[model samples]
Target chain A: MTSPLEQKKIRITGPSVVTANRTWDGAVVYRTAKQGWSTELADSAIVSTSDDARALLAEATADDVGAVGPYIAPVELKDGGKVKPGNLREHIRAKGVTIDLQVPA
Target chain B: MYAYDELDRTLINERVSEFRDQVKRRLSGELTEDEFKILRLQNGVYLQLHAYMFRVAIPYGTLSSKQLRRLAHVARRYDRGYGHFTTRQNIQFNWIKLAELPDALADLAEVGIHAMQTSGNNMRNVTSDQWAGVAPGEIEDPRIWSEIIRQHTTLHPEFSFLPRKFKIAITAAEHDRAAIKIHDIGLRLHKNADGETGFEVLVGGGLGRTPFIAKTIKPFVSGRDILSYIEAILRVYNQYGRRDNIYKARIKILVHELGIEKFAKEVDEEWKAMGDVGLTLDHTAIEEVRSRFSYPAYEKLPHMPDELKQAAHDKLFERWRKNSVSAHKVQGYSIVTLSLKPVGGPPGDASAEQMDAVADLADKYSFGEIRVGHEQNLALPHVAKRDLPVLFKALDRLGLATPNVNLVTDIIACPGLDYCSLANARSIPIAQELTRRFANHDTADLIGRLHINISGCINACGHHHVGHIGILGVEKNGEEFYQITIGGRADENAQLGTLIGPAVPYAEVADVIEDIVEAYLALRDRPEELFVDTVKRLGVEPIRERVYATR
Candidate 1:
């Protein structure tokens, strides 16, 4: 019987990617090779190995000037090499808000 | 509204300069993210799922037209052309750049607006009745006391780093529009038999992971002693509140654990010990602060002008008048609620253009005064009775004249998973769907005075716990669902809603609400008995059975 916070502390399984928000404009970004951050999930450097995930996350976390709150999140690999966020929350973040916003006159 | 003095302006300008420096330091890599997060939060900047969100305080929900126009400018210049008015009587911009927040704050500060104390473990904005000054039967304007508390608690050294975030609400009217019972400290202005005014103090009520209706700690605290009495409560809470567990750190938990009697005793002792703290709220002091507020010079006009009578002939304007208009303390004026919950529109969102339009209307019709209510609607606090027809047409042109103030269609929904990082599901779409179902004015007017509040999660930002019809979104098996509750209300008789039954999927929420409405319509004692009163008269079992029977 673990608490929700403690459960979150456990390492996620399967392929994962490091994601954060750009500090300047707060755009959602993902970590890539060479310590790069990209707004596109397709460009994100996905890793399966736990050590590789930890290393990528640590690199993004340390570079606070470029990004903030970097963490490794599980990703789902679809048919034809298509990769997207594994959950609805992450999918919304990668895309945008779910509804058509009211355009004020 | 209270105007800012030179000292207030200087203090905020200095704050803007300091925050600009902090943002610059963070961007230049001189400060860590951990270090800058708290600093940014102090200035009302929060890192959300998609972007940085900024919140600005509209103290006691009162905003002059000038201040409102400035907000419109901020929306267009800094955000995505709109802002969200929250349940706490504050406005939030969902897409602010962290770098540009300082400039935004400065622009707002030019009109004496800031985002301070909107977040973090400090005394948050002091909320009060939106119709405070102009209401018909209020004891005194609660904004005066709310302002006094705001001045006392703004950056007060002792309560700065409290155990948890503290919220205080004050209401001068008997109708309890401020929802005072659901705050850390609730003050209701009361009148004694001798015509002297005082505050009936309540303590330790909140809604988040846990919800509690605040209990009265003191039945009466005289006008001269209200400030001292509040200080005594805060001191007691600061001394004895839980710090060991973050989940159990609110003053509500302390009051619950210590028991109200014991807590009241402790507060009494503290009040007695602090013999003569010179913060006496005497008549002279009260009049001095009251003098700072420039009230509208109202004309002595007759009741319900001919223009309003002529406008009532039109069915649409009649419905809008019946729902969105209320009696004012002034003879010829009315309090007009401009609905933000248009059919299929997002709740509480005002585009920059809409904000500008509202400011224009406020200037033209309402003595340049506007209010943001805790129910996510805007109110023109003082509108001439003769001006109702013109105002309704103006609001209709702006798509804000949805005649559903207390109706079921006037839903309160948080920016759920759509924008909030902590949300478990989406609330806006459900709210939109429900409104779409009840968009017919006749249907909505028939099901009158039913409040539906939706929260994305248990944090209750939308005040689901106190709604007549409460909807709490939950995640189960990686899918979105909602738990519906009944009988909750926000007034003198504030009570948390009881769960009806099991969770329903996203697609079925509107139908569930329909079932609840049908159940109430079928079983209510009379048309005047509200949905909550019906639920109270007959327990939720009948409603639950009817709702699930359709399943």
Candidate 2:
């Protein structure tokens, strides 16, 4: 099991054009988990291929979601999205990648 | 007190005008709240729970009588006829209107004071040992460097919007009265092997939610390279510090994540780039700034005043000695700490009238010098012993002669729920009630020096974690509850207090504290055993048993 710090770091990018206000660069990125993206904002989340991200992005629509807009696509793990809530190891086993949803440092 | 030169006076006056325009713009809706927040905060204005709070900087804890008089006038005209001194050597007026801030700044500027850089994510007001020039133990005056750093950082455009707010403290005394270890940057002025004075720099210390004692990044940085070294550390933090999470944005988290070795290496790398450029100590500038803080004329006199000698044998003078007098570097002169902790009164509070009286006392008896301590107390750093009787008589009439500067009743408490929007519980009333309960000055003196810090929330504005007897206020079912921590201190030897079992109700806090003190008295080896040593040897078990046993 990879330590949270050892997880592959990826930059989240390009949701800014769709954002209501100024879009940040390399703004949204997540790390790949064995299972699914970790719910913790600090944890690394999995990002699937752009096609999968596009499809998930289409299916998601919520009023609260609209204001913040275009939540990052769910990383479709080879296995499934099911995983323990906070257990990073189990999260990796279920979801291939976890979404790192925050502004870039 | 350091006198402001023409340039200093002009800059402050210009800053007041610039801020007045900004305030006008903000009130006119030309600037939105998001835009105005940073601007207002830079001027030390905060939109708090019930009203706006204006935090004015008392630079390096030093104030002239003119400045204090100006503060009193501001308090009377703009605020609620009182001012609250803070643990950071600043003053906060809780009832100022947003529109009145411009006028307040103007008033402060007229006397060479302003609220610039007291807040915001930039460098804050530089703090030093309150006993800077007068302490016999000091290697050199710390106020010189404090003033230097104050001028260097004030309105430094490039560093304004760093990852988070930064604080710096300098101490020349070995005892560390400035709480240097718990600042963002702590500088201990030390003499090298060759007897050359320089600094021992520490980085990443703070006392907010995630308390950390800064590490020594450089054991010794030459006094000349101080600015370059600080620039390096700040630049590294600015470039690599986490902006993603506000909680982890402090330089401490960066030092924690990357490790201090790596952080220090990065700072070293940056420091090399600015070598011999932008920082060469500009000899003339150093002299220019240093001249403002030059030593005052010292007069030779007998060590003991006959009147004070006769009075010390008196009951009243003995009580005052227990609480008020501290040793001064000059013979026949003493440092007098005037306690604001009157029973049932707010800690750090001074009414406009009281402030005027203090200013009067400073002008008349103490060379117009006043210093504010980090523990929310005020000091007259230079007082002739011969004037003690007259000063004491005047103070006694004003009710400023509490004589419990560092006693159990000298509680350091936050504004808490009464004023602060962030408080989880009420703090002032608890402090007031406790001070009332422990009303005996003699009893407090008997207990010896013990710090009691109370905070409304985990933000630790009152520095509860460092109190010898720390009380943390929490809310339960819309009522106030307090959790006690024992043995915490932020002296030369810093330690985080340990939790003592279950939390207590607000009303029972004073009794619980009494029980804890009584337990210490019983378990201690001798009267020489102060609160910290007693708690250290016996551990919390004895006090825990005594406190909860009553249940």
Candidate 3:
């Protein structure tokens, strides 16, 4: 069976952003409009078309100093410059564990 | 229960300092990510989907109360308030920060626990039967030999960077509770006709993308020469094991490529070449290792305790006792398994408060020692029979007394897509839904001794291949699907489960299991026959027909 990440053969749908894991801490980071990585999706550079998404991913991959495994992920923009992940996995990666962390202070 | 000596302490302390320097280099941009990845993995750190995960090995699954308390402290201080006890008898902290990992290792070192060889292509944590010393069997304690192997294999220069990760399991009992047949190297210690204790070495058994039951390479190797034999096997594997393909680099592949006879011949030749080396265990050193295991001051009481007899009449206590309690070698003692599979909760997960409570319970009742079973449950290996009621009450209050050992609700599942980056589906939710479906104690009791193991992918971390009812998660067109297998057994008569039919959707997994169990209920000759036995008698035809027919 093909991997879920490799099964995407359809046309690029709506807005998307190039995201990867920060190399040092493995935190999820997104490529920003200024060619830098940001932890917040709202600060990311949103690409409306497939060509721009591909270019943004190429740029992220070339500047791999800060992150690894860069890939284009779907995102939804909200009012007040907010953004949320378009898939359950990316959402989990952006936030934290799905279950209760329950860490005592 | 084995306390670290000066050499052990020095090795661990030095490794921690070295790792601290390596982490510093990585952060300072002096080391590449590729270089840092190997360094981090060597110390049991992995970069998962969310954050870094650190796995700490509980050698032979034995932990002192002090050690377990220290783990709880680490979980609360460095990570989230809980730790996930794994199927390999290790505990993993999933939310570990990369920067604080050195400090966490330092704390673990203070308690004689290090994350050495928990990952990487070297030898992983050595696992053994949870009831190694106390189980009702006439054999030597396997932990002693496991510790010997651990000491020998830790950072061994020749075997440090094997082609792939190697796992070894030692079981002294005849029942094979440790799932020895599914390990890379399985050592079963037994006595021969002349009453000489030795190990029957089995090699190449593994459950991954390709599953194979281990084959006996050596009929018997003397207890003294077991290390030499293992060294021979590793030497051969290190030389000829596949290194080109990561997927086929495990020793099992090599064993498969070269038949068992040829593999045995190569290992025997290597063993013969290393004649009378220092690898042969000295009796004095063996005795020293054996002396470290602390034995409780067991009192000579009657075979049956009065409290237990009284509790036997109570239905609730009787049910709990029937499921959670096991016969111990000692007359007045019992092996009490604390179920980590609470209803609607993740399997093998314990909160910090629960850890502290269990540690206290161990100190109060079972000689301050706890054992983590490969089944993902904690066992009080030497609990007095008279303290059953109070212990059960304490466990009940902590939500640890689920009374579902080997039952349908006692599910073994891997940290699939929920935590693992390699997973194709989510195993925890499937396990949770199944446990909820079988929440009724009466129903669970009716379906006795049904081991349901779920793995998110073919990696088989959940030992799904050996489960009586195995569930493997797959992906098709971005949707999660589950493949069901039936009649697998992981005991003395071990056999891999057969895949029933086409993969079912995630939504239909629990119902498919229900269908299989319902068919077993209808087709069984009697309730005395187990699910595996019934499948063996009637074959998978009935279950397969029923499962697919319903769908």
lDDT (Cα, tens digit) per residue for candidate 3, span B1-551: 78778999999999999999998887777777777888899999987777788999999999999989999999889887889999999999988877789999999999899999999999999999999889987498899999999999999988789999999999999799888889999999998889989999999999999999999998889999999999999999999999999889999999999999999999999999989888877789899999987788889977888998888877888889989999999999999999999888888888888899899999999999999998889999989999999899888888888888999999999988888877888798899899999999999999888999999899999989999999999888767899999999888888999999999998899999999999999999999899999999999998899889856
TM-score of each candidate's B chain against the true B chain: 0.99, 0.97, 0.99
DockQ of each: 0.56, 0.02, 0.37
Error of 2 at B39 (Å): 0.9
Best first by DockQ, ranked: 1, 3, 2
Residue B288, candidate 1: Cα error in Å is 1.5
2 versus 3: better lDDT goes to: 3
Q: Write the per-residue lDDT of candidate 1 for residues B1-551, one digit (tens) a residue.
A: 89878988998899899999999999999999999988888788888889999999999999999999999999999999999999999999999999899999999999999998899888999999999899998888888888888888888888788888899999998899999999999999998778889989999899988899999999888988998998899999889888898778999999999999999999999999999989788788887777778789999988968898788779888888888999999999999999999999999999999999999999999999999999999999989999999899999999889989999988999998898877889999999999999988888878879999999998899899999999999989889999999999989899999999999999999999998999999999889999999999999999999999868
**TM values, all candidates:** 0.98, 0.83, 0.95
List clashing residue pairs in candidate 1. none
- In candidate 3 chain B, what residue range of length 10 has the lowest lDDT sum? B26-35
Residue-wise C-alpha lDDT for candidate 2, range B154-240, written one tens digit per residue? 889868988889999999997988988888899999989988778999988887778888888898887778888888888898999
lDDT of each: 0.90, 0.77, 0.89
Model 2 ranges off by over 4 Å: A1-105
The candidate with the higher DockQ, 1 or 2, is: 1
Model 3 in CAPRI terms: which quality?
Answer: acceptable
Q: Model 2 lDDT vs. the true structure?
A: 0.77
